[model samples]
Target: MSLRKQLNDILPTLLPNNPAEAIKGTELIRLARINLTGNYSDASLRYHFSIMSCDPTSAIAKVEKGQGYYRRSEPLPALSGAQELLAWTQGRLDDISGDDSSVDSAMLRIRKFRAVVTRYYEVNGRFPFAFRDPFTNTSPLGNLWKYPELVLVDWETGGSPDEEMSLDGGMLSLKQRLGIAPFRLHSARLRLSPSLMTYREDFFQTLSVSMWAQGGELIYAGPIADEALADGLRKLSAAYGVGVTSFGMTPEVLDDLPRPANILNAHPKETEAIMAKLDIHKIAAAQSRPHLDWVALNSLRSESEEADKLVAWLNHCIDERRAEPFKDE
Candidate 1:
């Protein structure tokens, strides 16, 4: 069967409302242009179809349609069109939702959707109607980031910081020195958490690993000038059982850290005075170590029946963590 027919049949089961109608309309338009006129480009067809998946009556949807025209008119307009469409979608969603709490939830969904579309454009040099499972003919929020290993990090803090140390200065400095773009840096209080008060260094190590698993890099930024704190960070890195790199508290080395430009435009920096004492390292090494390998534990659960129940329990905790609202500091 033609892909359009398959989609037409499947979409009703999945959407069954205005969204379905929009998708069907998009498919019909695409098929007619292709089968009869043979003038429609795949990129143009997919772009229109994806936009139609949004509410056709929405102002953002209108902008999306305009973007399609722009994309068809020229080669370089695809990225601009996609970017504008995303911004409009986000703005429209915010305007309608009018709920502060749902902002992160909504952004998360949009980012995931953006990531997929951006990747497709990057590879194919055009927008695509590539509706993968969760995003199929539905809003991006239908499925957000999910990893079954996030729950291992304890969220409760024993108390507030004795003195709030703003790491913005250090983070900006690190970004300048490293020449990396801005990325989310977890606040010191959030990073140190139950570990500092509990005096359980292992907890701090676990927290580092958890963040690494969720994001990719672990950055601890704080007053490393203190020798004791510096030593503690080294120990944390060692305990983390990952590849470790330490700049100590020396401003010279810290300032000398390699600056790599990236699209994220921000690097994760550990910046809590109390929590900043740990050596930061790439967490990729953990995958080889079974005890600390959350991914391996989860993926291999079926193969290793003996650990299936334990893995399932661990995954359940991770799911609970994943469901929690995103905390951006």
Candidate 2:
């Protein structure tokens, strides 16, 4: 077999998924030698590593800040194909002009945008719960109308979500007596770009999914540069109370970012550096409701395992009277 093909088959198994755990070139070459067809010089293998890491199709990836390589995550197959991608892009309403070659590239961009948003919210004190099953390959397109990509939880006491913090006794009691939720939940729909034509669908989808929550937020990867788009979004938000915010990460910027795992697990300094690239704009603020829609939530929990997990996580935290980041056991 050709060396490139051999590396492709072997690298994914040997490499770590996270950049922090990336293996050095020399070590990786030694590991690859075990499965390689013929004796290859270290220099040749290193050169191949350097070249293949640049290819998005290749399984190997170099660390953004250091000297090592890791596995590049495969694109999710849920919404593959250029036609499906352009349907969601923020360029134009009728702009499904791209060819079929952009499926993997577009899917990777979507994954990166999601990771950045998740990390952004996590660091900013809101615990984010992602809805995955609804976007799986086997799921229906109508799921977009019913499920949000993310739901953000903001605790009332302003405690560290990284560790368990005691809920305030008096404040908790007061809210309980007043028949109000101790925390505010906001459902969010995430998109790669913002377009003048498709902003309403985005707004309403956010509103629709958040019907059971306190509020809804429509978050975009790119900035809201077009005034008309911003105006339209603001008007919708005013009428419906859905929040809109832009992270200012264009497709090019998202492409330049590290893998999802690296971004989520970056050091404090690295995280700050990654965050520095964002030019966040809150186009319209969300209106919060006092309590959750139990009827809607009860119905949703029956449809989505993620919903049940979300509720279980929240219940566990409340039962313990402590706030901590959600973790799957």
Clashes within 3 Å, all models in order: 13, 0
TM-score of each: 0.20, 0.69
Every candidate's CA RMSD: 24.4, 16.2
In order, the Cα lDDT scores of the candidates are 0.29, 0.76
Q: Name the lDDT of candidate 2.
A: 0.76
lDDT of 2 at 92: 24
- lDDT (tens digit, per residue) of candidate 2 on 128-191: 9888777654456677778888889987653555443666656777887898878889998887
**Over the stretch 1-329, how does candidate 1's per-residue lDDT look in tens digits?**
54444433443333322211233445445544544333556675565445433422211111111222111100110110111111222123323345555444333333332332223222322211211232222334312221111122222211326322122344445654775422221111112111121223323433442442322212222112222223444565466533222212222322332221221222334112212432333222221221234464355444434335433433343334221222222
Query: What is the Cα-based lDDT of residue 215 in candidate 2?
Result: 95
Give the clashing residue pairs of candidate 2, or none.
none
| lDDT accuracy of residue 262 in candidate 1 | 24
Off by over 4 Å in 2: 1-101, 158-164
User: In angstroms, how far off is 109's CA in candidate 2?
Assistant: 1.2
